[model samples]
Structure formats: C-alpha cells, structure tokens
Target: METMTTSHSLRSTSINPANLIELELLSQIVTQKQSANDIRGSIPYLAKMAQIIDNQRLETTVAASSPQQQQLQQQQHTLRLLQADAHRQLGQAYMKIGQYIQAEASLTITIQRLESLLKDDNAATSHSIIVNQLIEGYDLLKECFELLGKPHMVQGMENRKRKYTTPAPAPTQATASKDKSSP
Candidate 1:
C-alpha cells in the first residue's frame, strides 16, 4: 500500500520521493483509518495527521533500506544531536527528574552516526565539530521521534533529496543544433 512520492531520477529514476502514486496510496490508507462517523476529528487536523502518517511511514521505510537513503539519514542524525543537547539543557530546568530521553536521544544519534560512517564508503569525508555534533544529535532524535510517532522527519528529508541529487538540465537537441550553426 505504501507508494513512494519520491521523484524519479533518470540516474536513479525509481528513487524519487515526489512520486504521485505513492501519495495516492498513502491517502487511501489515511482515509480508511478514520471512519466517516468520527465526530471529534476536525477536517484540518485530519489532513495534518494524514500527512504526518504518510511522511512517517515513508521515512521509516527509507531509513530501514536503500543505499541512497544514507544521505538524508546523516542529516537526521545531525539534527537529533542538537535536539538532544536542547533536551539536556531543558532537563537542567528540572533537576529532580532525569531527562533520560534527551540524553539517550543524543547518545543514540552519535552511535548511529558512527555506525553509518563506518559502513559508508565516504567515511573519510572530514566534517566540522558542529556537523559532528549534529550527526550525533540525529541519532538521539530518531529514538525520541520514534517514541513520539514523529517518523515523518525522514520523509521530510527525502523531499529535500531532490535539491541535492537532481542534476542540472541539459540543453535540448535544438539548442545544440543552433550552437553548431552559430558564427
């Protein structure tokens, strides 16, 4: 039932997250989840939740598999690290109760990043301290997000892959034909 809305890359045409068929399938699932008789759910809220669910499911699926999934997964790790630090500081706001989730999220992100780097061919790419920190954070965030049912973060990232992966447009044959005739 899960269809990928990921855009088609001619290089990797099957991987696009902007896929329409994926959206339609996800839409159907969301519609089925909430029946017509549910009086308390607002239309706007339903729409938002539907988006979140579709996004989360997509995110989880991509995170679990795909070689291309690595790029976005790295970004998520970085984000989770930052979030964990914020949670740590906030934990200071109330010393009695341990901010376990926050700290755990941060550590988790760090470990995940490390594992990713080890597994990656590009592990040699040097990064700044800030980037490193963020990578660690993403690990933590993934855990927290999973617990909170916020898996859509990964899907949101897939949406961004288009910006980084899509190649520049090549000129048409007519343009090439014109260029050859010039001067």
Candidate 2:
C-alpha cells in the first residue's frame, strides 16, 4: 500500500516507514474490526502489522546519550510493544475463529515477547502493561489448551497466569515490629 517517509532533522537518521503511519492505520483497523466483533476480519491486519513491525529497523546518527538517540530508543521500545500486542490480538482472533492451533502459536509468541520485554530493566514501557499482556497471553493459551483437550497444559498455564496476577506476600509481623522499633 501507500508509504510515508519520515522527515528527520539529523543528517543521517530515519525510522522504517513500516513503523509509522502505515502500522498505526493497520492497528486502528484491527481495533475497529475487533470492537465490531469481526475477529476473523481483523486477523489479516494483525498478522500484517506483526510482520511489518518485526522487520522494521531504526537508523540514527546521533550519539547514544543524545536526546535524538533517546527518542529513537523509545520508538524502538514502542514498536516492540506493538509487535507483542499484534500477536496477542492475532491469537485472540484465531481463538474466536476456532483455530486453536494458530491461537496457541500466536499466544506463545506474545508471551515470550512480553516476558523478554519485562526482563529489560531499561524498557520504556510500563511494567504493569507488560505484565497485563503476559497475563492475557497466558489466559488465552490456557483456553487454547482446553479447547485442544490438553488438561495438563491448562493447569500449567493457569499457574503461570497466577504468577503475574498474585500480589507479593505481606511483610511478616516480626519484620514489621522490628521496623517499628528501629524507627
């Protein structure tokens, strides 16, 4: 389709066109189709977006510490998040279309990507967002396993989902009393 070139003030700097308006439009279309309950219709768009984002490359001439470089890094992070989301959406669409095999594959990819992003201490995206996405991926995968008649896989996926959703244990009463005395 149509491609738009990004204008960069730096002498040698550019982000892949696929990572810009085109991807955004595709994402919006996918969102619309999903909201309209046309999950099958959204599948192609989500898949296309995922493919495009995965192939994108960010080019920049600025120093690593420069603001321009920081901006580019942020864009890269955002693109990664979008890529994970696209897969997640694709999985959901496949599930709605009764394609459990495809759903499992896509959700697995989504979960791996989110988990990798979560491990990055410098990820610009919020931890909660990544965690929530991971939880959603696990939930979808669990459903996929159930549909595929894989009860063992379902229990494992449920445990993984709980890992993200369960709150950390509260401080012990002894620890709390010790802190009170110290202060």
Candidate 3:
C-alpha cells in the first residue's frame, strides 16, 4: 500500500516537506523490515507527527481503494462522517476567534455533507442491514444547519422548499418557440 499521487492533503495540518520525506523513508524501512518502534527517533520529527500518521493512512486508503466500488463507497461514507465532525470542530474554532464567515462556511460544509449522505440511501442505509436510518440522519442534519444560522443557507433551504412546493413556472413563449425550431 502506498499513497496515491492524486490524494489531497487533509486540512488538519500541512505536512512539512522535511518531515514528510523523513517519515516516508522511515515508513518504507519500517514496512520492509518490520522493525521496532525505537526507529522513530532518528530524525527531526514533526511536533504534531501529522505526516507520519497521514502516510500510514494514505497507504491504507490506497490499498482499500484498489479493490472495488463497494470499498470506495465504504471509505467515502466514513470520510464524509469524519469531515462533518472536522467541520464542526473547525467551525467552533473559527467562531471562537470571531471569524464568523469561516465558521459558517465550515459548518455549512458539515451540514451539506451530512444532508447529502442521508439523501444517498446507498451510503446511509447501507450502514445497517436491518433498517433505514437515513431519514433520521437527514432530519438531524437539517436541524444542524438551522442551528448554524447562516442566512444564505436558510435562504437556499427556503428556495428549495418553494421549488418543491410550487410547480415549475410555465416556459416562456420565446423559449418554447426556440425549442420548437430545433430538429
């Protein structure tokens, strides 16, 4: 297992180039020789050790991703849940610093991902075999977004509601005429 070239770095922390290189080399040695944990002390280690963790994680993901779409789906489901939690935490952090717009954006991403997951019966419903819990999660996500208090999100929600509640407006005559002229 190895990291894919197209893998996006996580937002939790940026991997320092030096640390990434060192850790990746160490990772190779560790994997090849299956040595003891004492091998970790050889280099200038990253304080948070983000690169090492990401290296292992990226390897695992790549290996699993090579298998099938079912594997990909499961991975995506887990990632979405994790992303929601990360966004919530990030939003809270941003709010504490008075960065309300950043907070709102992060929370909105959280809420939107959760909502999308719920709507995807495959992701949410597939989690358990006995029953469909997707709708329950859907409602919870709706509440979460409302709690976040973003004006645009609320407006978007309202617009979506109206779209479903009211039928689509009849097409304009000019558009109808143009359509009729098409072969």
Best by lDDT: 2
Give the TM-scores of the predictions, in the order they appear: 0.23, 0.74, 0.37
Best by TM-score: 2
What does candidate 3's lDDT look like per residue over 88-142, in tens digits? 5455445545556655665666656666665664643454421222233233334
For each of the candidates, the C-alpha root-mean-square deviation to the true structure, in angstroms, is 18.4, 5.6, 14.4
Specify the poorest-scoring 10-residue window by lDDT in model 1. 88-97
TM-score, candidate 2, is 0.74
Q: Per-residue CA lDDT of candidate 1, range 104-134, in tens?
A: 4434434444444444434345333444544
Residue ranges of candidate 1 with Cα displaced over 4 Å: 1-58, 62-67, 92-183
| lDDT for predicted candidate 2 compared with the true structure | 0.81
